[model samples]
Target: MLLLINVLLASWFYTAHGQGKPCDYPVIKHGWLYYSYRGYFPAHVNQQFVYSCDRYFVPPSQRSWDHLTCTAQGWSPEEPCLRQCIFNYLENGHNPHREEKYLQGETVRVRCYEGYSLQNDQNTMTCTESGWSPPPRCTLVKTCSKSEIRIENGFLSESAFTYPLNKQTEYKCKPGYVTADGKTSGLITCLQDGWSAQPVCIKSCDRPVFEKARVKSDDTWFRLNDRLDYECLDGYETREGRTTDSIVCGQDGWSNKAACYERECSIPQMDTYLNAYPRKDTFKVGDVLKFSCSQGRIMVGADSVQCYHFGWSPKLPTCKVGKVKACAPPPQLLNGKGKEIHKEEYAHNEVVEYVCNPRFLMKGSHKIQCVDGRWTALPVCIEEERTCGNIPDLDHGDIKPSVPPYHHGDSVEFSCREAFTMIGPRFITCISGEWTQPPQCIATDELKKCKGSTLFPPVGKPAHMIEYDHNTNKSYRCRGKSEHKHSICINGEWDPKVDCKEEAQIQTCPPPPQIPNAQDMTTTVKYQDGGKNINSM
Candidate 1:
C-alpha cells in the first residue's frame, strides 16, 4: 500500500503537463517555497501547492503568508516580489524586526527603549528597491514633550524637556496656588504614551464666604490677582476696617474684610509739619478740612480735604524743603516759545506752557511742569515740512491720494479711467515738493498701431483685436503666389510675415534616358491624362 501511494503521488504531479507527462521540477510562485512535506503538487497549468517563506526574510505580519499555485490565468491572483530591500544599521540601532534583508513592500517596526526617545523619528521602516528608507533610529530612553504636554497652572520640576522612560518628573504649583485636590505638588512617570496624567493647579481657598458683606462684581469664582470692586449703598460706607471701592484678589481670596455701615468721619490731622483749620477734634462726614504747612515747609500734596463716603478725599499734604532738585533752562526748540516766568527760581509744581508758530505742530509735551524742582519735560515744535503740491490731473484718468497734497517722501498713485490705460509710470513721488514722472492715460486698445491688413492677410482677425501691451498670433495663408503662414503682434508691432512658397509643379516628365533593356510609359488619372504626365512604365 505504501509503494502504491508513492506511485500515485508522482503520477499526479506529471498528469496536468500532458496526461502523465513529467516536468523537471514542480511549479510554484517565484520567491515562495512549496511545502512538499504535506503533499507534492503537479507542475502543470492550474496545479497548486502550499507555500511558505523558508530561508527568506520574516515579515512583521501577524497572519500567515499566502499559499501560491499555478494557474492558466497566470497563477490566479498573482503576487510578485521582484525587488527586495536591504537595510543596514550602525551599532545601537534597535529595530524589533532586525534582518539582513526584507522583501519589497514589507514593513518593519521599532520603538525607543525605556528612558530614550526618537528625534525626528523614523521608527517605522518600509522596504523599497532603493533600500529601507530611513531605518528606525531611536534614542535609548523615553521622554515627555513640553509642547505636547501641559499641566494647568503647574510647571514641571525638570526643564521643559525630554526625559527617560519610567523616569519620574515632578510638577509644582506657583506660590499662592495649589492643586485642585489641594496638593501643592505631584509627579508623573515618563511613558511611551507620555505622562499618565496632567497636574491641575487650582486656586487655594481657605474660605470663600464673606460675612456682613456680599461679594463684589457678583463674581462666584476667584483666582490670583483678580480684583473685586465694591459699592456702599444708601449713603452708607464700609466699616472702619473694611475696604470699599476695589479690593485686590489674592490666592486666599480678597485681601481685606468687607462690610457696610453708616458713613462717619473724624477731624483729620497730618502726622508732621501740618495742621487743619477750625482746630476741631472730630468732624462729621462731608466736612472740609483745610490744611497748611508749617513755616519753611513747602506743601507737596492736597492743600485741603473733604471727608466723603470713602474717607478723606486726599491724604494730608507733606512738608519738605531741601530734597528739591533743579533743572536748567528748558532745551531750545525751533518754532516754539515758552511762557514767561515770574519767579527767578522755578519751584516744584510750577508749569510753563510752550506755543508753536503758525503752520507748525507741537510734538512732545506742551507744558514743562517743575517736578521736585526738575522740569517735567520740554515740548517739541515740529514744522509741517511734508507738504507735497497738488498732483496734476491726467487727461484720461484721475489721481487719488492716501491723504491730501501727498507729503514729501510720500507717493501719489494714478490709475486709468474707464477704457483707458496708462502709457508711462503709474505713480509719481513728491521729491523736494515736486511730482516725479507721471504717466499718460490713453484709450484702451487704440494705442496699438498694427495695420489690420498687414496682420490678417486680407482675411481673418486674431482671436481678439490687437491692443497695446499685448501679445497675440493669427494664422494666415497668402492670397497670392507667396503666402504668409503666421503673423504675430507684440507691443503694437507685427512680426515679419513668414512666407510660404508652393512646391514647384512639374507638368510633364522629361524625355526618359533610355536604359538598355527598358522603355518609358505615361499614365494620367486626371482628365484623360490631359497631356500632363508622370512617368510610369
Candidate 2:
C-alpha cells in the first residue's frame, strides 16, 4: 500500500518537472531507438534507443560501461547508440536489390526505374547515428535526340535539336503531294527513344511511259493532270505531231494513246484557227502538207511538211494566237497613250491610234496596224518636230525617180551613163536625213586599145555559149560552120572572129555577095538603116 502511494507520488513528480516528456521515451526526432528502456523521472533509468545486431547492424567489439543505469546521468551510454537499416521502405520508381540491411558506414545503393531518376541521383542511402540518411525522390528529366527522330515523306513541326518527355509535334507532306488514305497521319509522340512512327504520302497515279516515246520533265513521278510530254523514237512517228504524242495522268492511271508508226504522216488534231489543208487521214511518201492559220492567228512552226520514207520532213506546224498589232504591248511613249488602250492583245489587221501628250509632237506614221501577224509602221510621240537634210550628188550619174527634200528613210535609184558601169549600191537610201553612200557611174574599160573581132555565123548554123577571161582565148563549135570559132578576152570583154561556109557547098564566088538567095540565106554584117556601105559592089 505504501509502494502504490510512492508510485503515484513519483509519477506526479515527473509530470510536474518534465513538462509531460516521459524519460523512457527520449524525444527521438527523425531517429529510431536502438533498444528498449525503463524510466520514471526520479526512479528507474530509461534506454534512449532501440538497437539490435540481428539484420541491421554489427555489434561493437567491446564495451566499457553497462547500459540501462541511472546515476546523476540521463541514460547509460546511449553513445554506441548505432541504428540498423537492413531493409528500407520503397520511395517508388527506385530499385533496391541484393542487400537486405545496412550498417553504419555501409552504403545502400538504389536506382530509379527507366526514364526516371532521383533528384540527388547519388543512388545511395546510408545508415548513420541518426538513421538512414534522408532519401531522394524519383524525378523525370527525359530528353530525346533530334537525330533519333526520322520521319519519311514528311518533316517535324518543331525544328528543335532536343525534346523533353511527352513533347509532341506534327508531320506534313510536301506540296503537290498527299498522304495515303487521304487523311493526315496522327500527331507524332516522343517516346523513350524518338518519335512514334514515320509518315509517307502516296499519289493517285505515277508517270506514264510509252514504247518509243519520252517526256521532257526532270521527274519521273507525276499526279493528276500532270501532262506527260513525249516524242517518237528516231525513224518512228506518232499518228500526227508532238502535241498529239502526249498523254495525261488521271485517277485511271495514264490516259495515253500515242502509238509509234513507220513511214507515214497524219494530220494532228489542232486547236481552232489552225489548218492543214486537204488533210486526209494519212499521207504516204512524197505527199506534201501545207499549214496555215486563220485571219486572226499566225503560224508558229514550219509552213509546210512533206511525207518522206522516214515520216514527216518536220514534226508538224502549230498555229498560235496572232493578236499582233503594230505593237502588241503598245510602246510606252514618254507622254502618249493609245486611243484603244488594251494592255497586251490586238487582232490581225487591227489598227491602233495614238495621241501625243500636250506640248509633244507626233513622229512617224499616225495609224499602225497588225499586218500578216506583224506590226506595220509603228508611230512614236516626240517632244520636238523633225526634218531631213540635203541630198548629196552622185558622181557621173543622175537619180531616177528622185525624192527631193529627202526625209528619214527616203531613197532614190541611180542611173549610169550609156557606156558606164554602176559602182556600189544602185539605190541611195536616206537615214536620219543623211543619204547612204551614193552610187558612182564607173568609166568603162576602153576596148579600143585592145581592138575587137566578130565571128560570122554560116547559114543553117547554131551558136554555143562560151566562157571568156581577161586576155584569154577560147574556141567554140557551131552547128553548120565548117570551122571552130576563136575568141579573145580583153578588158573584161570577149571578141570573137570566125568565117564559115557549109562544107557540103562550094565556096566559089558568083558576083560574091548579097545575091538572090534561098529561104536560108545569111549574111555576116549588115549596114545601119539609110547608111551607105563602106565598099559598094
Tens-digit lDDT track for model 1 on 120-171? Answer: 4445767765556554455555566766667776787778576655668788
lDDT of every model, 2 decimals = 0.57, 0.54
Q: Candidate 2: list runs displaced more than 4 Å.
A: 1-94, 100-200, 239-244, 257-259, 263-537
Residue 299 displacement in candidate 2 (angstroms): 36
lDDT of each residue in 260-379, candidate 2, tens digit only: 655565665665777877759988655667767887666543455666544454445456663433336555555777787765866654566666664455554344555445554444
Cand. 2 TM to true fold: 0.24
Which of the numbered candidates is closest to the native, going by highest lDDT? Answer: 1
Model 1 lDDT vs. the true structure? 0.57
In model 2, the Cα lDDT at residue 342 comes to 67
